[model samples]
Target chain A: MRRERRRVERADDVGPYRLLRLERDGLDAGEPGQFFMLEAPGRLLPRPLSVCLATPAELAFLIDPVGPGTRPLAALAPGDAIHLLGPLGRGFRLDVERPLLVGGGIGIAPLPYLSARLGGPPALLGFRTAGHAEAAALLPGAEVVIDPVLVTDALPSGHDVLACGPEPMLRALTAIYPDAQLAWEAPMACGYGACYGCAVELDGRLQRLCIEGPVVAARRVTGASTMRAGR
Target chain B: MIPVLNASGCLDALTAPDVARTLDAYVTKTVTPLPREGNPPPRIAETDVGMLNSIGLANPGIDAFLGEHLPRLAGLGIPIWVSAGGFSAADYAHVCSLLDTRAEVDTIELNLSCPNVDAPEEDALAIVAAARAATVKPLYAKLSPALPNLPGTAAAVAAAGADGLTLVNTLRGLALDPATLRPRLAAGIGGLSGPALRPVALAAVYACARAVDLPIVGVGGVACGRDALELVAAGASAVAVGTALFADPGVPGRIRAELAVLRGRVPDPGV
Candidate 1:
């Protein structure tokens, strides 16, 4: 359906490449690890975006404006006919009682939402060299990690961590925790799990991230890389 | 005539409300034996050519589907093709056996690409074998584009007694955040679908048509009537609008009206 949500609502640039918030009063159907395919005019391919927060009336996605689709999506005004497909794919599972939040880059979008859902937990969040308003604003009271030294210093002793973002950061965190649930991202064609393109390994199984997980426990990943068969 | 919509799971439940009003055949999401929560999110990822996804079989189990969503769907005034999947042959049989008894369900679409949830290394044939033993209804197995031997798989599926086929599922792809320099989606990988996959889906359709005699339902990147016509030229009896449906909800209805134009282009079967 040509949901002119894009036409009716424009994405407000929140921070750190994050460029969309479904400006509805509270139409948040999104979940952590779920994404949106942002489509604007003249852009054939929709931009893949992640939802940081999703309320029944509000839906928020943080994206880096990169190519034709994203650039225009970033330029959307307060109300535009939106053509978006989401809360597509699978979302993170916070079923565990104690999930130590671990975030890297804008992947931190889902953190506060998860924290809110999990009712808040002490976390270890990593950012780049400088501070990002989106990250700082979204993640309050969490331990911040800017470098390896910080990650080394910040990882807690017993709490299981749930992380999303830079592979290096996730890898580093996984090296530290080794058993944390890592959130991953893969390019997708169908938000449904038919395609094997968005595939990753978990406990030696080749499962599509869109369907099986954007989150897999640290111990299940066999390779340091995402996608590709153990290659 | 009632407009035949893409029986494949094309329209996301969240599309514009008008889309529901406009479509002729809106298929439901793939259902399974027990309710499936689906794969974890970071479900979608971007790519240079298109997008990818891995929404594992997330659907309310058959009982819940019959008790809950079906009533709402019945009111839609369109034929519903119930898409079902399972890891093994036995599992497929069980699910279809359940769906076969449901009233709102008019047809069954077997997902050929669902890997085992408990053991994810299995192939598509197990699903085919299961659906064969499961139901006598109009059963359609949705196949994948990236399969190693597309025609062979289609032939094998036909020999296994498939009623029809929905050719081409997503091709796996990926994207990343340059600033953080990491993968863009949480799953790290996703199924690729869009215009870029049109040729792949078409090729599979053409090959499978010659390989086997069952009606083929072509999908992948159908955004317009012209794209749908192209699938027909390649050998599809019908075309499914998957990714394009997200962008233009009315494309299916539009494609249907334009079918006569395609008939004009094709050589008469009698000749």
Candidate 2:
């Protein structure tokens, strides 16, 4: 949970997103779904990003320039310096049989790392267009879907499901795979539990997503309103 | 010497004990009489200038905090200040009385103005007076910068027996969604905190410093050592880091070192 100034190694294009690779700088990449708070230059608040990939040398984030905060993050270049505090929050539980990875759009950020941890298990991804689906290349042999064909439409029974996506997709997946480990989203001021800004309705109570989970049992979440809490 | 503290409801000490350890004093989140679920989600919005939060004072209630959180916080080796919140004067007084006996509690910060909740009809002076009567512990009234007559309120609160003051809670703000053009926060309006708040905090601290002789703990958008110095220059005896701790947990130590560089001596908390 140390905040360090890390230099950007490179920024690679992955479909509509930017894969900003940062010098590892000895920072622990906690768990697959655990996130880092990246300080965007000139922005008042740092944006919370999930670990997209963590190699021995570098940690990478898939940035979706959805709003004001993320635009500068996606626009990073080689040699750029940024402050990052992480690997915060709870991530996917690794104990499972017949592991399956599920992601949608930018939610695919954690899959590459999670897959590596889970022995490169089967993955199903959904995106709005082929350009966006190009991120699936990060996962070597995952199944991809283009909406109006949702990733949920192709879920295979008997596999322990772990998923991340927009509210609609996560809710639908929760209905089918109640015990699935679903990664949730919320606008977070602090990646740690301090701010309580990342709270979302879970099990009929408002719980800080950054603390209780960025990852949780799907059945525990009742409403996913903070999904609109921005990127 | 400017002591550094954390704004109430901003840093949860138990979750980030290392971060809390850097502060001169660790202020707990506003403990209310009853447990709070807080407002619905979409509780935070980040604008170009700062961040807006409508967390609505959510907590496990004072009893739970005293039982579960206080002991651990006391063990952290930093001086503790409890931020007390409630709907009525009695609520404030009752909570204050409970902390009056806790040796771990070095101060009681009466949260008179949290923009996230419906403002109480009872004014800051009444709240201060009520809490003042209930507790032997030092009371520092945390006021809002948005108060129409801040200096006057500060004077009144001081006269009513407040030992000190925490100048400037977050100012009221609203952030609209760019595409939808609607309120971004579910609560519609929230308390704004960050660099954007430094000037407003300075003004409040400056004005309150002139109005009351008591020590003031300045808070709002204190991101760096320069900001803390500016607040001190504006008559604040201490500064509390709020939003910046979220972005950088190491901020307190950095600010302290920077302050030492600027002033040539480490500021004592004087707790």
True contacts recovered per prediction: 0.22, 0.80
Off by over 4 Å in 1: A1-38, A45-68, A73-231, B1-4, B12-21, B115-126, B257-271
A1-231: candidate 1 lDDT, tens digit per residue: 233353334465455465466755434465666666566556554445667766655676665555556566666666655666666666777677677887777668667677777878887777765545356567688877675445547766777778887676777777787877777765554444433445566676556566666676677776446642110
Error of 1 at A167 (Å): 19
Write down the lDDT that model 1 would get. Answer: 0.66
Query: Which ten-residue region of model 1 chain B has the weakest summed lDDT?
Result: B114-123
For model 2, what is the alpha-carbon lDDT of residue B26?
A: 95
Query: What C-alpha lDDT do the candidate models reach, one value each?
Result: 0.66, 0.90
Residues B1-271 of candidate 1 have per-residue lDDT tens digits of: 2234553445544223356556655677777778765565445554557656666666677778778887787777777788876666777788788777777778788876642234324556667776767777788878877678888888887777788888877766776766587866665666677878899988998888888888877887787767777777788877777766645555666777776676577653320
| Superposed model 2: Cα runs more than 4 Å off | B265-271
Model 1, position B101, has a per-residue lDDT of: 76
Q: What DockQ class does candidate 1 belong to?
A: incorrect
Model 1, C-alpha of A218: deviation from truth (Å): 28
